[model samples]
Target: MTWEVRFSGFGGQGIVRCALITGKALSMYDNKFATMTQSFGPEARGGACASQLVISESRVLYPYVTLPGVLVALSQDSYNTYEPKLRDGGVLIYEEDLVQPKEDTGRVQMYAAPVTRMAEEIGNRIFANLVTLGCFAAITKIVSAEAMKNALPGLVPDRFLAVNEKAFDRGYEYGLELLETRPLSIEEAP
Candidate 1:
């Protein structure tokens, strides 16, 4: 199976890091084939940035995502820029507070989590990406949470690992709650 995923947001949101961590977890820990690419604006922060991941059971021939099957959008600008490019029947995971989604097209499945707000509750907003990653894992079942945690070392500083792990757990649990309550399996978009 192959999955095309995109993680996008303004800079300083760890958009690129999200893809990196997921790719590494799948490829290195979960024994899948994953290729990743990144694009970002010139500025260090508050500029558009994105990372694309192509995950498969076999080798990946291409590096970019043409039509994403899974989109993780953390900002309104990113949701606006990438939502239209999502494939039919695709899955969209977004931050509810940060994005006001357009009317549903009835072709894609959408789920939202307040990752940034949750991160703030944990002490820093920097962990929002990790939280989102956890939500993505739980909702998509693309990779295991154990694999994600195994891939975190060296990527996340030792001092912040505990908080990051907590953030991930919070998001993962929230995603599970969403699935139980909202049912992402529904064919029609909500």
Candidate 2:
């Protein structure tokens, strides 16, 4: 079965890095097949950016996402652009401070976390993506925590690993807490 996920935000927010880390974690450490595709505008910082990931137990023939089963939106623009593309009963994870989702369609499950503010508390806003990744992992349960941790060393700088690790832990814990309150998880794959 294939699971399509999209991570989206303005550029410089590490939208691409979120997909990269998730793809690496799932493919390299978790023994899953994952393919990623990305798109961005010309501006480096404010441009809209999106990364699509396909994860499966077997080989994935198509690399692009037509309708995402899970959508992680870190900005309002991303939410506006990708919300309509989400399949019915899809999961939506968003930054609480940045996104105000549409009226409840009664068809999708949603979770919001203050990842950027949490990252700022940890150190910098740059780690927001990792924080969001942690939320994604804990909420989705598609990729294991060990796999995600194992995939981080080579991805982040040696000096910043500790901070990033902290950011991940914080976000993960937040996700777990959210799950306890919301009690929502991805529906079993058909």
Task: Give the lDDT of residue 115 in candidate 2.
Answer: 93
Instruction: For residue 153, give model 1's deviation from the true position in Å.
Output: 0.3
In the range 1-190, model 1's lDDT, one tens digit per residue, is 7889999999999999999899999999999999999998789999999999999989999877888889999999999999999988888999989999988767788998999999999898999999999999999898899999988998899998888889999999999998897676623221
After superposition, candidate 1 runs with Cα above 4 Å error: 186-190
**TM values, all candidates:** 0.95, 0.96
Tens digits of per-residue lDDT, candidate 2, 87-189, equal 8888899999999988886778899999999999998999999999999999998899889988898899989988988888899999999999888755754
Estimate the overall C-alpha local distance difference test score of candidate 1: 0.90
Clash count, predicted structure 2: 0
lDDT of 1 at 44: 93
In order, the Cα lDDT scores of the candidates are 0.90, 0.91
